[model samples]
Target: MDQLETMTCSRCGGSGHFSYNQIHGTRCYGCNGTGKKYTKRGAAAAKFLSDLRSIPAEQFKVGDLILYQGISHSKFVRITSVEVSRAKDQGCYSGDGEYQQVKIQCEGGYGAYYRPGNLVRKGCGAEMKSEQLRQALAFQATLTKNGTPRKRAT
Candidate 1:
């Protein structure tokens, strides 16, 4: 992959300043208050990576599963709708330099806007299913009464 280009810091919004509380502000940790950040790769290169793991917005369809890049947790969501629009310039780290925006709706009724290159297709259905199964089993284990294990059927 080609080296990533320098982009604005998503955390500080390229301002080099962030609020710590209602009364105080501090330098952004993500960029050391530099107001700029480097992309892991350029937008075009990022598209290639996204394509390997996710379908591009131009090709997205209803009911397709996708991974939202802006969230902290790794969760695959079913896409319910897609919208395309123009984005405003964000200083030095602006997306694609073309300002294109893509909005997506998930099955859980949550929605967010992103650059097309930021959205990736999820490729781990089995992993997600297994995780759900594990959680279910753990919940079942917590339901035992008086510390007694459930008896097995003969």
Candidate 2:
């Protein structure tokens, strides 16, 4: 991994804190309150490293967790097979009857068929603020060329 360059947090002016008014101040979300932020190249390298571990969506199997894109605080859904016996037991497949009916459970425990596009694997390095994506990137900066992490100089 290339070195992640640091910059003074513009939102907080290197203070690690931002204030909307004299009475209100909060830690800078931009830099995670470290007063330093990553350069564009650094961020891209981190993202590229993450993108390397992802596999094609079509390869997902039973019990795999998927994160649906284009939604906020999206919960991970595990794939489970649901058998449909009759026409009334059918799931939502928004296509013509020319193809065989496929059945699968979806959000809210309803039966639905998923196209499996834009779904990210749970282990993928795609950023999730709640999941410490940046923290992992920061840790990556401390690793040696051999892929082992080195201690800070203190």
Candidate 3:
């Protein structure tokens, strides 16, 4: 039986050839110019992609507008996302990442991110009486388009 073999590198034009110079003499190899190797993607890559999609909108503030689309009375939210976070310190490397629920605030009050679509939810905004919410949305949209100044994120 016979087996097949593949080229080690395609960078050198399949010659498998490379050159080097030493204090004593010069040398050449048939494999590589530097004898280094390439590696594949790691677990970090997958985590990064997942994080990108799950952006923490809760970081936004009171006058911010978020992309919201559902059966709710309104198609968008005028208030900012609210996130409750707690710090956890083990010993050496202290870090904070975990989160719970996000809520949107309006002149009337606060509500769950998903409760706006809930039938039993009761609130001025929930009842579709969102004059303030509507104004906030419109103002924020125009401000965003005109590049109006906003508070810097802390």
- Identify the leading candidate in terms of lDDT: 1
lDDT of 1 by residue, 63-111 (tens): 7777765545766788899888876676845457657778889888766
lDDT of the candidates, in the order given: 0.63, 0.54, 0.38
Give the winner by TM-score: 2
lDDT per residue as tens, model 2, 16-109: 8875544445767777678997665455546544554444454556665555443345555666653332243234544453333334544556
Q: Return the clash pairs for model 2, or none.
A: none
lDDT of 3 at 83: 49
Ranking by TM-score: 2, 1, 3
Deviation from native of the Cα of residue 37 in model 3, angstroms: 45
Against the true structure, what is each candidate's TM-score? Answer: 0.39, 0.42, 0.24
Residue 63, candidate 1: C-alpha displacement in angstroms = 1.0
- Encode model 3's per-residue lDDT on 51-79: one tens digit a residue: 33233545555665444544555434456
Q: What's the C-alpha lDDT at position 35 in model 1?
A: 94
Q: Report how far residue 106 has shifted in candidate 3, in Å.
A: 3.2
